[model samples]
Target: MSGLAKRLAGQTAIYGVSSIVGRVLNFLLTPLYTGRFAPAAFGIITGLFAYMSFLNVVFTYGMETTYLRFANRPGTNRRDLYNRVLTLLLLSSFGLTALLIALAPTLMRLLGIPPGSERYAVWLTLILGLDAVAAIPFARLRLENKAVKFASIRMANIVLNVGLNLFFLVLCPDVLAGKYLSGLAPLLRPLYNPSIGVGYVFLSNLAASAFTLLLLGRELLDFRPRLQVTYLGPLWRYAYPIMLMGLAGMVNETLDRVLLARWLPEGFYPGRSSLAAVGIYGACYKLAILMSLVIQAFKYAAEPFFFAQSEDKNSPRTFALVLKWFTISCTILFVAVSVNIDLIAPRFLTSPEYLEGLPVVPVLLLANLFLGVYYNLSVWFKLTDKTYFGTYISFGGAALTIALNFALIPVLGYMGSAIATLVCYVTMAVVCWLLGERHFPVPYPMSRLLLWLLAAVAVVAGSWALPPLGSWIAHMVHLLITLAFVAAVWLVERPERAFRRTQAKAA
Candidate 1:
């Protein structure tokens, strides 16, 4: 392997370990959340996070990408650039957080949230602001190629968040019920509701965000404030378009739940059908997104690596090879998830009401697969320094997403949202690949890649033809299906034989 390919592989492993483990830990929380919170509560959780995701992109305003770009520039005083960017982000994010908190009630009402529902808006505002400040250190870690520290911090945050959640949602509730209820009833009586489900989860998140911020203090203190107004013009020129692109991307990804909150039909529940659907969709979406998170962790490390490698002669071939392998692995993941969703779906939300989302799971997984491929391929524009391509492609995807949601939400509701998401990702991936070739071409192995994907999809489709069995039996069948797909890939790739030969020679 070339140096870049080798680096990509190593960072991918580190990223994989952290991402897979963190997601698994977060995955465990889904059951607790679904069991404890009402669907409506989950709706609030979903909506608040959706709002946070949008603001987060805006808060950073494309500085993460800018940092990576400038850090690689010649004689650039990378640390000074880091400090300047970090200071700008910290000041802006805190200012934005304070502003949002003050305007929370008005924003809440404007978004159709109840007047006093500003509680969630407040929590999300602070958390996302802290997250924005934290992004600089995280991006700096990536720039310095500190994948281990990056993964470690991520895992630590997940561990803290998950532990706190278990404490609040499980241990505290039990303690109050068993030992303290009689004594505390006068002052803490409202804490014992078996049903105030989603609020506890959000509270746990707030606590975790505070904890993560504290842990980041050393890195925070290391940076000196240096606002280079001279850098702002070029930075904004580059980052502003990327910010718009990020907004469009987030809308394509998350606008579904927000729109569904309004588009879901009446008679669905007493007063909280939207929340219930949000909980269901959100939980199952987590399952589909596990693969996406893995991709994200890799992209976190991969983007900087790609840009640095662009100056090398062998970069085109190396990038093409990585793209091939990424697609192959991701396609396999999509198959595994689709075939075994019957088993995996229950672990997240076992309720029958939420199981209706099972069918949507496969659609969502494929959409995420497309999304991962798009991100991997997107290095073309970033390398060429023509990031305006990002704005155009993402805007196109967002347009498609909006039009589809508006047209289909009233007709098919949540399912419409799912279909729309899949359509948007597929469209973006295709457009990106087509446009990328014009400026920065790589020899992506389309034929073998399609064969591998077709094999996985065929196995899943064939499995559906069989009669329904018990859950365990169905899981076993799906596992077999996935294993068969993997075996076929190994046979075709012949990686084991080549590895053994290399080992023999080294010995």
Candidate 2:
């Protein structure tokens, strides 16, 4: 492995401590929530978080990336720039929280929540506000290469979050039932509400976010920024475009859940309401979120890694290899999950009611693989200051996403949403790859890469076609098929190793 690749691996490993671990801890909650909550109840929980996903993009307003861009420029005042940016984000987050709290009734009504359930919106509002405030502090850790600190806080947040979820979803219910604390039941009566089932999920998240903000005391309390109008202008100029891209990209990422309740026709599925369908889909979506975690872990490392590598002449080749390896890994993940889902889901992933939408999981996994490739393809635009091209691509994907969701949700329900996700990502990935090659050509091992992808896909498709056997027998077959795909990739890469050796000798 090259030095750069080693560094990338190290950084990715450190960052994964948070991204991967945090996600796993949270992923564990999926089964717990799915087990206890009905499809509609869990769907409400999923829908609320989907809104937060988009809101995080809005609340941060691209300052996360903008800070990175300006902070690294020569002769920049690091402290001043940091203080200035943090101040703006602080005000924005606080103001947004106030506005949402004041208008909770109106906004919750617009979101189609019941009149009595408007407090969920208020809780989510506070959650997003605290997260937005903490955003730059987290980003600063990444910028400073404080990977350990970053990972620590992230682990803390995940542990706190998982612990709270357990207390609310598991212990509280047990306590109310007099399972352990008969005497304390009266004291906990006000804290626990059986009807407020999904509210516990939001409440846990709000407490977790607050704990994180408190941990970053210095960043939160810093108020000595110059508030320079001059600095603000350039940052906005660079950031707002990224913000546009973020908004559009988020639509591609999450709009299905947001719109499903409204766009999914009345009486589409036999007994399930639109929100119920959302819950099923969202629960199944969590099954594929393991792939998403890998993609996210790579992103937290790769975004900065790519920027730093822009000056290296051999970077294009390195990036191409990175894409090849990433595809191979994602393929392995998809096959592993798709094949063993039966064994996995029953054990700890989701409940029986949420299992109905399990078919969408494989499709969503493949879609996320394409999305990962698109992020790798973004090197050209980010390096060349043509990031606005990203905006255009995201806009195109967003349009496609919205149009397809509108057209298909009524007919196919959540399955339509899954298909739309697949199509949108495939389009975006292909578009970005083609355009990036024209503007910033890389010697990508496209042919061999696709061969590995196809092999993995083929093995997975064959697994699907296999006869149903006993549980252990089925798992054995799945394991063999996945291993076969891995071996095929290794065998194909073998000759390339020899060829590289030959080239090295010639040099």
Candidate 3:
């Protein structure tokens, strides 16, 4: 690989290592939650998180990307820019927090939560506020290539969150059961309220977010504080579209859950409630967590990695190669998740009730793959300063997603939501690419990427044709299929040719 590609890969791997470990550790909680909470109760957790996704975008207001975009430009005051961003985000975050906290009671009611559940809203506001402030520092670390420190803080947060979850969800519950820790049952009973069932999870997250802020306090305080109202105009001009695009993207990603619940006809299920349907779909969504994890880690590295190299003469080639490799990686993940989901869903992800929604797993996985591609394609808008294009695309996708869910949820339920998700992503990716071709073409090798996607789908589907061999044999078949994909990428993409071609042109 070329030096830039290798460096990008190295950073992505470093970031990915932490993400992989943290997500795996946290991923264990899927079974813990599914095993513990009833379907409707679990549905409440899903819906809250879905809303959190949107609220987080609103809270940050795309300041993280704004900071990165400005910091790398020529003749800019890096420290001054940092200070302005830090001040704006701090004020906005806390101000937003106050508003949400004051409205917590009303918001809880609107969300269908009981009166006592206002603590959930309060905790969520605090988490988002702190997280928004911390995001700039985290983005700084990415810009400065401080991946090791970044990974450490992320992993530590994960450890604390997961450890606390074990205490609240597993150990405390068991101790209260009088089944294992009968001797300490009296001591722990008051501390572990059975009534706070879902509340415990929220409380644990609150503690973790507070701890992360403590860990990042130095970075937060290090910046020299400043505010220039004049500078605010350009920053907001650049950031507003991004912020809206982010909100709309969240709508595409998360509104499905909200719509799936709200749009369901009153008598859709004779015995099952709409919330119960959400619980099933949400758990099945976890089966695709690996795809989300990979995409997230790539984004953390890709934004800085691409921007830092934007002025390079060969950056287009680099971008093309990155797209190919990332597409290959996503294709592999799709096969792994879709093929093993049978064994995966039953044993660890969730209980039998959730298994009813397993059909949506493959659909969501493929959706995330396209979602990742759209993220890569998004660099065009960011680089060209045509971020409004992103707003348009995301709003377009969100409209389609919302419309599809409303139309189809009563007919097909969660499957309808899943279909909507895939359609939206595909639409966004195609539209973005066509616009990029006209405005900021990047030579994305669309034909090869399509082949890789089709190959992945074909391979995953063909695996089911394998006989009911023993579990070990079936695993071996999957293994061989995965390796075959590796070989195909090597032959078709020809890694060495790109290096040689770039070298020949340079020399």
Off by over 4 Å in 3: 267-270, 464-479, 497-507
* Residue 463's lDDT in candidate 1: 78
Candidate 2: tens digits of C-alpha lDDT, residues 189-305: 887788877787888888888999888887656646457777788889888888999999889888999888889888887798888888888888888888999898888888778
Pairs clashing within candidate 2:
none
| Model 2 misplacement above 4 A | 181-187, 218-223, 494-507
Error of 3 at 212 (Å): 0.8
- Please write out the lDDT profile of model 1 over residues 401-468, one tens digit for every residue: 98998888777767788999999998898899888889988877677777776776678778767798
Model 1 Cα shift for residue 430 (angstroms): 1.0
Q: What is the C-alpha lDDT of each candidate?
A: 0.80, 0.84, 0.88
Summing lDDT over every window of 10 consecutive residues in candidate 1, give the lowest-scoring window: 185-194
Give, for candidate 2, the lowest lDDT window spanning 10 residues: 493-502
lDDT (tens digit, per residue) of candidate 3 on 1-507: 678888988899899877988998888899999999988898989999999999999999989999999999999888888889999998999899999999999998988865688888888888998888889889888988999989998888888989999998988888887769789887887788877889877888888888888888778878877888899999999999999999999999999998888888876766789888888888888888899999988998999998998899888878887887888888888987788776677876557878888889889999999999999998888988889999999999999998999888989989999999999999999999999898887867799689889988888778867778788787777778877877887776686876786578669
When sorted by lDDT, best at the front, the candidate numbers are: 3, 2, 1
